[model samples]
Target: MWAKLVPGKAVATPVISYMLNKAFTYLVNYWRTEDMESVKAELLKMLPHVQAVFDAVDWDNIKEQSAALDAWLWQLRDAVEEAEDSLDELDYHRLKEEVKARDEQEASGSVSKLKGKLIRKLTKHVPKNGMLKRLKESVEGLHKALLV
Candidate 1:
């Protein structure tokens, strides 16, 4: 995915759009249930700053005239990539927990097993504090990059 960001290409819009989509999906699915409200809210808050930064710059012009601006853009891109990776990690853990719950339910051979065990198992896999901290930091980094 990072390879798609060629220096002079019009990559910002697509990358930002994709990140927005992923963030929204997480908000819808996990925001309240997974105790990720703060992290998700911070992410939601930062995204507009990101969009504004992208909007404020004429990247094509900067590509030709300013090596420093090019470097800044790369920094912003790296932040976005980091944020995306954090979201991907959250999704991976969520899916892994779901599959584990399903396997446990099947092994138990009781449909009723799902009601309690699945919820408990799913909650157990809520992103650890370290993961949440990393995600929050990634979003904060992106916000800081936008300020630059």
Candidate 2:
């Protein structure tokens, strides 16, 4: 079977690593509520370990094993996509709540000056629930691959 190639050029390594770093950072920095504590902890733990593994890769010599590297990169990509999907589920819920809150405020007979205040809050990056177990498993799988 043909393996999908990863762009392992000198420039692409840094860019690829940067994208992974950004995704990990976003998950780590996300605000957490009580219900999210466990999931947040899992993400916080997994991301740094994954980052360390990614950081330790010999990017310059990667082309020597292009086939193997391609396989590994594809696995990483799949794991990253799964993580993003899981996080997006939480974002969906957070947005739904924001919209509901805004509607409620608009329906209330508040002061004229305060009419739009709630809507303004909706624009804020409300730090945000997704399948924690699935996300954890996907990341852990990537982590195991990195170990090899």
Candidate 3:
């Protein structure tokens, strides 16, 4: 159902959790079954409402920042592809090993490790003035979503 609609990533986790829990609770409590048609209709309605809310949020550079991030990711992907294309067999294996070690470390950096790093990063990046208030609002949102 959610796959058919678009919502801000900020709201996505909460909305998915809420809907899943609600639907599961309903089924368990009443032993009722649901059809996809009804779910699809609900999803259709939700998409527009979500669009409206996000549209109303006048973020100055959020879109530009997200696009820049996307561009950087694309550049990284292209560089990796180009490097792969240029690699000779022995060099490819060496690069593969290097990548494998990095990937392994990344895989080991679980949610707890990520959170610790994030806290340290926030301490470094977060400025005073209204920025902290905005940060607090963002944290409050995730907290209410049971995500942070």
Listing every candidate in turn, what is its Cα RMSD in Å to the true structure after a full C-alpha superposition? 5.3, 7.2, 19.8
The lDDT values for all models are 0.65, 0.53, 0.40
lDDT of 3 by residue, 7-113 (tens): 35456434534543443333333333343335434543454444453455434444454764344333433432332332232234446655654565577658755
State the lDDT of candidate 1 residue by residue for 1-148, as single tens digits: 2224545345555666577566656554544335445544655566666556556666557666677777877887788889888888888887887788777777775666857586775676666656556665676677567667
Whose lDDT is greatest here?
A: 1
Q: How high is the lDDT of residue 97 in model 1? A: 77
Q: How far off is model 3, as Cα RMSD?
A: 19.8
Candidate 2 yields a Cα-based lDDT of 0.53
Question: lDDT score, residue 125, model 1?
Answer: 66
Off by over 4 Å in 2: 1-64, 109-130
Give per-residue CA lDDT, model 2, range 1-148, as digits (tens). Answer: 2122333333433443444444454445552334444543454455565555455556556556476765675677676566566656655766886777667777867674275675556555444323444544544554555555
TM-score of each: 0.64, 0.45, 0.20
